[model samples]
Target chain A: MLGRIEQKVLRGGRLTPEEALALFETDDIHLLGRLADTAAERRSRGRAYFVQNRHINHTNLCLNRCRFCAFSRSKGERGAFELSTEEVLERLEGSPEGLSELHMVGGLHPEWPFEHYLELLRAVKERFPRLGIKAFTAVEVDHFSRISGLSLRETLARLKESGLDLMPGGGAEIFSEGVRKRLCPEKITAERWLEVHRTAHELGIRTNATMLYGHIESYADRVDHMIRLRRLQDDTGGFQAFIPLSYHPFNTEIRGGRPSGIDDLRTIAVSRLVLDNFDHIKAYWVMLGEKLTQVALLFGADDIDGTVVEEKITHAAGALTSEGLTREALIGLIRGAGKVPVERDAFYRELNLYGDRYEDRQGDGAEAPDRFRTARARQ
Target chain B: MRKRLHPEGVVTFVVDRNINYTNVCINRCRFCAYYRGPDSPEAFVLGRDELFRKIEETLEEGGTQILLQGGLHPGLDLSFYLEMLRSIKERFDINIHGFSPPEIHYIAGRANLTVGETLQSLRDAGLDSIPGGGAEILSDRVRQVLSPRKIRSAEWLEVMEEAHRLGMRTTATMMFGSVEGPEDIVEHLDALRGLQDRTGGFTAFIPWSFQPKNTELGETVQDRPLGAGGAEYLRIVAVSRLYLDNFPNIQASWVTQGIKMAQVALRFGANDFGSTMIEENVVRAAGVSYRASRRGIVDAIRSAGFKPAQRDTHYNIIRRL
Candidate 1:
């Protein structure tokens, strides 16, 4: 299977997660290189993209006790807290500038009514009619449905009505239950996690997928993770990007988990080579820091995720990729990484392409030409 | 020349935070985009009050160690470090993982004290450990071209040796893919191995790429035949594993390289995935960005076929997540 996949990948074909996993173990680095290059080319066939978004985690107070989580506070912990809908709205109001998207995701709050979340979404959508609402993870969706005593279909319907445009790929922590049990036991089963994202896709909403690495799993487990995500993406076709998250072993329930940095970069490159289906591989600017993310572009990642006006989850987990980054900073990082910077919409749509699209004023006084003049940005 | 990674599997004792004690530094190293000139408004040689506050915050965040890394200021000396270390131990009673090779060498030169005496003084004043900073491509050609005033490779490794002889263990780092070639990388690893072969006081060897952003190095990324790709990243890991044959552990550089490439570096030969940095402004300021938490890194390693264990500055396994 690995050999066949390598051949196909060399011929510019897609490999399944199973194939990717098998290929990961292959000693043929050249063959693997061909497969990765093919996948990258395929992923970039259309216009490359980036997003201008603000990450507003509604609440840090979570009901489910995921052991690997350092961010979540038990309902009664000193720092445990949830934001009111007005507070969430106020955060959104701070982001009405150039941002066209508000990314909201948080722990499964113990007692926020389903309608309360919808109100949060509805308020932001109503307030900024143009800004797309990319809120919640599949875990939150399942939680809201169970709490509201409504099936997921009805829950999603209500959310869609409340102006939920898409979902950010958090809480799909790992796809394997064996690993998930050890890391984050109470969040959701691996299968159920995929189910929530899959169901969201059925409702015509696109979502991202994520993998948390460098903790307690094996290489085979990583392969298993990519395979699971690829299989699900193949079935649902909803996953737009695959974000491979790095683990920091600080201020968490577990005693120790200091992974090597090189291993982190290797996982990302392998993910790109292996996950043949996912379009964008994001070097999320939050966890790995800005410099590493810039270098990540050469390895296999194309998309450097947005300037998160605010981020709580990674911060809660003792990482600094939280808070905001201006578009100029984002473009600067991307340009420094030596790639053409293209501003993207919420759902992976190109908004504006900068650098070289318009010549420097010293060279050409003419106005910049709209490269994709008819490009319709999908929110 | 078999490769090695200094002292392997030593760091895993307690929590550590990268306290860029002061962004203010006097040196203008070409590759360093993170530092601010000493006179700049943004420049800040963290006051005793600010350092104590930062240390208190790190302790509150469950950190046991602080990496107090900055630049080689021209005027600061042995007294400067003695006071900083003394103040920290005086106030917090936490571990002081401060300074690096160049700073030590510079202080030794300024104080007219031997490297051994300087480290001895710092250790006496409660300096616990040293981060391997100013190690941007450990070749003299790269060193002179990058930062002419900064101590050369021999001086940098000499300080580590003197500290090791004086009963202080420190971490070693390699800043590769800047100006030096692969052979230069071998030089850095070899120097580390030679020192570890004798003193055996080096804790771990960390190699990160040069982030060229807002730096004196300017906007010049190499268009080499085989650039800093996954293959090159893996080679560094594998070679570090092989060349530093006596050094048992090679860390995956998630700071210079992203998490995925860091993972692949595991295959080449890396046993550790650095820190779950609470706050890393230096690398981010240079522009490589990706953020991962305790859960994310653990899951990544688990998924990649290893038990994610958090370690201390000495590489002692603290928690097996």
Candidate 2:
């Protein structure tokens, strides 16, 4: 069974849903990893991507209290915070130079209208114009459309006009309706999420896609989720990357243990093999931790996400990784995996390739010069 | 090599529970997340009732031995350990495999006795064997960075040698993937092989990866791979199997690596699945919580094409499934 699938994958043929499911159930992890690694090398020519990006989770005062989310809170809750536009700007003010992107996502505020999100995006863009703004999930976009009494296309047009360069693929949890009903019933359905991304793509705004695994979802549900995204990507080549979010189970209404490292790596490998339309598969270090993320690079992941300065969402759910990683640390992690570290923008355009010439470039006053020096000495 | 080592095509595991008697420690190693200070709100020493209850449960569940270990509490003397061991022995007829070298060395220093004297006293108090807990890298160069306050390499080896000379068997372990290079790992294996050649009292060699979730070392070592990966783990298992020719057994740590990777390790070189670990808190404190029942271990071994057997502390087959 795997032989036929391997031949199809190696020969650049699309995998049927049954074949992908078989790949998921197979215990031959080494062969699965090897095939996925070959597929990844074909897509990305040995260059792993990272961005000098910062995350701004503006508010946690959410209306739809998803059972799987520990980051959201009620309005009067003790830890619920709503950052004003000035506070958001102030948070970005502390960001280091050479920062290429600002990833902003938050809970659905019940009171704030859609204009508030537009104003926030415009304010961030007017201040840090060079930082590409990757803001909002498809779920948030649908909420914006409903709040503003506008169509989905109109709402996305206003957001794009307000300097939203890209959309992060969050809130897509699992596309299977059975799991979605229990996971986050109040949130938008899978069809609406896909519609929001499709409209965003039609309006010339690229985005990424994600699937939240390691919760109550099954292997079949995961394969279904990826196939849905692959079908969408097949129509609109808009997804720049596909991220498999490892479900961190801490302080959530659905309190389950985190998945094993084997499950995490297998999900990454299967996503790379199944999501053939996606050019990049990100091992988001904020959730996977640095060590597992390094191993994921060998298991068919081509991106380590980014430096992820001040990632509050996963940390709010008891992520053990640091809130942020220095640029030198990201480089060290990628290099330690024996891959070329290519610093990319929000759209994954190569901004700086830290290859063999990285040592010489370290002396030219990169960020955290002392730390970079120490990293060099260690190498 | 695997076939030559095990001609009967059997993989063995011990049905034991790691009972940490106390959490208070003075020599808090950086890579350890299980130790607590003397005055911390979470510091605790198991009472006699709780210890006996745990042993009774283990015995009820067909567990043959108790891997009794603990942190070196500053307030507890040798009498505390002696009482704990003697009380358990008086209550239950189970094998008591307790105390790594660092704990023995610390107890010896506190009581002003030699290593041999400490082993003799513990044996007299009903310690059946010793476990290898605190031997992180077995190189002074690496030990200085990881655990300077703990026992030195020579002291750890001296305590193990003393136990062997006392006719008490012990296991050896290596916690790699933390601030150590390949040379350091080689040095650790070389030290274990040399000792096994001399004494032949070392029962098995277990190499588990260093899980760096809640440890201070995880915070400091941010630039490199925090711990060894699955491939590196398999490489270490294969190398240890080939290098330590005098050692009789190699254990795959499912506590650190999950069941799937542990099954893969059986193909690499491991002849034993380490333990069922009905209760494990040390790795849980490190943010990795992997649990396996005896049925799960047996199933994993059978699926990996090896016969599963339950063994005691001395690797004697107590039952075959």
Count of steric clashes across candidates, in order: 111, 0
For chain B alone, what TM-score does every candidate structure achieve against the true structure? 0.89, 0.98
Candidate 2 per-residue lDDT, tens place, B49-118, comes to 9999999999999999999899998888999989999999898999999999989998998999998998
lDDT of 1 by residue, A52-164 (tens): 78887777888887777777887888888788888877777766466877888888887788888888877888888878788888889989999999998889889998899
**Candidate 2 lDDT over residue span A49-161, tens digit each:** 89999999989989899998889999899999999999999988998888889999999998998889999989999999888999999888988888899999999999999
Candidate 1 segments whose C-alpha is farther than 4 A from its true place: A1-5, A14-18, A26-34, A45-48, A256-259, A320-322, A357-379, B1-321
Native contact fraction of candidate 1?
0.11
Tell how far residue A234 is off in model 2, in angstroms: 2.6
Fraction of true interface contacts that also occur in model 2: 0.11
Estimate, for each residue in B158-272, the C-alpha lDDT of model 1 and write its tens digit: 8888888887888888777666876888788878888898988877777776665566664554222112444455667767777776665667776667665666566556777
lDDT of each: 0.72, 0.87
Which candidate leads in TM-score? 2
The positional error of residue B118 in candidate 2, measured at the CA in angstroms, is 4.6
Q: Which model scores highest in DockQ?
A: 2
Error of 1 at B190 (Å): 18
